[model samples]
Target: MHAIEKQKSPMQSLAESVLDAHTANFWLQKINPLWSVSQPLGKIIEIQSAATDTVSLKIKVNRHFLMGKAGQHHPVIVEIAGRRYERTYSLTQLDQYHVLLTVKRIAQGVVSQWLCNTAKVGDVLHFGQPYGDMTVTPEQQPALILLAAGSGITPMYSLLKALDYSNKISTQTITLMYWVKQHADAAFANYFESLAQQHANFKVHIFHTQEAPCDARLNKNHIDFIKDLSNSTVYACGPSGFVNTAEQLFTSAKNFKSEAFSLTPIISDEGGFINVTLTKSNKTIAIPKGQSILVGLEQQNIQPQHGCRMGICNKCSCNKVQGATKNLVNGVENTEPRNSLRICVNSAQTDLIIDI
Candidate 1:
């Protein structure tokens, strides 16, 4: 005999046909902003000043949200003036249902400015699944060097908290070198100092580069004070130039991992322009080679959806109909047709057609 299968009721069938999931969710959100059929949402619970130009928000996430690893980043979506804007920020999981997001206001950053100044307690925000590979593991070396610059300290703070929660801090030697423009710009300084005092194996150093008698930036000379580079695991997060310098200085470490929040696109020596055809928009534009497609498009008054322009988020990804492109970050070239390309990190090497 065949097994019986449950069938949908007439009302259920009618509802599914008449109202899509998005329409239903729109109604659901009217009752409770955090309520969603499938979208992950978070309600801001607490707000505090983190630094001179930074704010920390404690958010309570809904059941649909999936907590990411300590050092991963989550795409935050917010609506402003009926237009949705997305940005990626490193999240620190406070508990099973809560996470902390820190925002450093940028001069012209719409999302950051809104998050830091306009967002209020009880306001809800949407989130995408977390993505990143710079995570902590049990197999890592006992000696860990965490190097952070400016807003890059957020992920390092998360990593440290995770290590402390797992009771691993007491067994390992951890050193944190955090760089900021001034002492007032340093976030979580007290917390890190207290942790270092509580745990003898932990050490914290705050370097202010723009203060009186500035401390030199990351260079080979700084490595003289750090012990056992050959046996230590080095993790760095910062601007492209800072991360690049760290990589060069610590290349001899046992293991090196890094993530850059901002990147300066590498200009190719072969200076030329390639025509890029947008299939959906029915437009063709000439873009310079070796420059990111996103930048090129913006220069031509074409703005594609983008976030965290550093290649950490997939907001700028588009389907390539045909093209040869090079990844600016890793210098990998691709000529395969019908492939997904991230415009923010990839430059067109040849005339191309893309689904934008």
Candidate 2:
């Protein structure tokens, strides 16, 4: 019996056991292919290619799907070549039955590349609870400014569609400044253009960095396009450099929110090697000084628990029993023993022992 069933009486258990679902564990999913229970699984019902290197998947969530506020992200898990990988994505709710996820193919990105190239209809994947705080709240219903570049436009797209669909703002005074490398790389261009045509107050400005070099980027000259910029709440997402540039330009906005892609540090080979003791695995490996501990472990054919692989998710966090490590995000070094650190973001600076 399942652990949760321990609270029931013998007679109650017997009475409920008449149904195969109550008596048997979740093995029914495999035993009977037609059964659909309240599991946290989603089936891919449709797939659409959105742009040059991007694909949108329409997933029909299970009965137990818990919807989240628009613009929030959910950690999705998919298996490929007998190895499971996890990544976080912002969901666009089509309705209670289905949601949309857009994946942009990154160079050598495991999950993104798989979804864009090989994933097909009828594929089922698991997802964790929705997370992220980039949503628009009722109190923030003022003039809005959304700045997005590359794949960072996803969360902002969710928020934009939710606001427009809910009719929460009658004036439609949302201004979106989207930056892309070229015209072909821009996703959802036609949808944005349609919104601009339907509403007089809704405006969109597209900056093509490659095709129209001189007219691209956000600077002092672009600030004139947004009316009442000081009173607007600005949300920006993109690469770290683009986000930092947006933050600097929108310093005077009423509220500023930003989320950037994980920072990729240039791992240098200036320092000598150090020993890394994996306590649980009862093994030790020599890792280069300037590389992430996770990458170092993987080189030795050891896999540790991880999700998002970016520091945003705490799944890769483990105890540093002794020695020093550095945070790649801020360049801050920690030397105190018996502390928790994210293996994905930190590189070893000295001999270390960790609980993995």
Cα shift from native, residue 124, model 2 (Å): 1.7
- Model 1: lDDT to the true structure: 0.88
1-356: candidate 1 lDDT, tens digit per residue: 01223354454455557789888677777877876667889999999999999999999987788889999999899999899988889999888888999999999888999999899999999998888888888799999999999999999999998998889999999999999999999999999999999998898989999999898888888787688989999999988778878888998999998888876667667777999999999999999877889989999999999877878777789899998998776567999999999998888899999998
Candidate 2 Cα lDDT to native: 0.79
Instruction: Note the Cα lDDT for every prediction shown.
Output: 0.88, 0.79
Q: Put down candidate 2 lDDT per residue, 1-356, tens digits, no spaces.
A: 00121254454355446656434324445553222343467888899988879999999876556666888778898999999788888888877678899989999898999999999998888888777677898789578888998898888888878887788545657998998888888888998998888888888998888884545676778788888988898988776557767777888998988776665453665767889998998998998777778888988888898876556667899999999998765567999998998998888888899998
In model 1, which regions exceed 4 Å deviation? 1-19, 265-274, 278-282, 288-291, 301-307, 314-341, 348-356
Model 2 residue 286 lDDT? 96
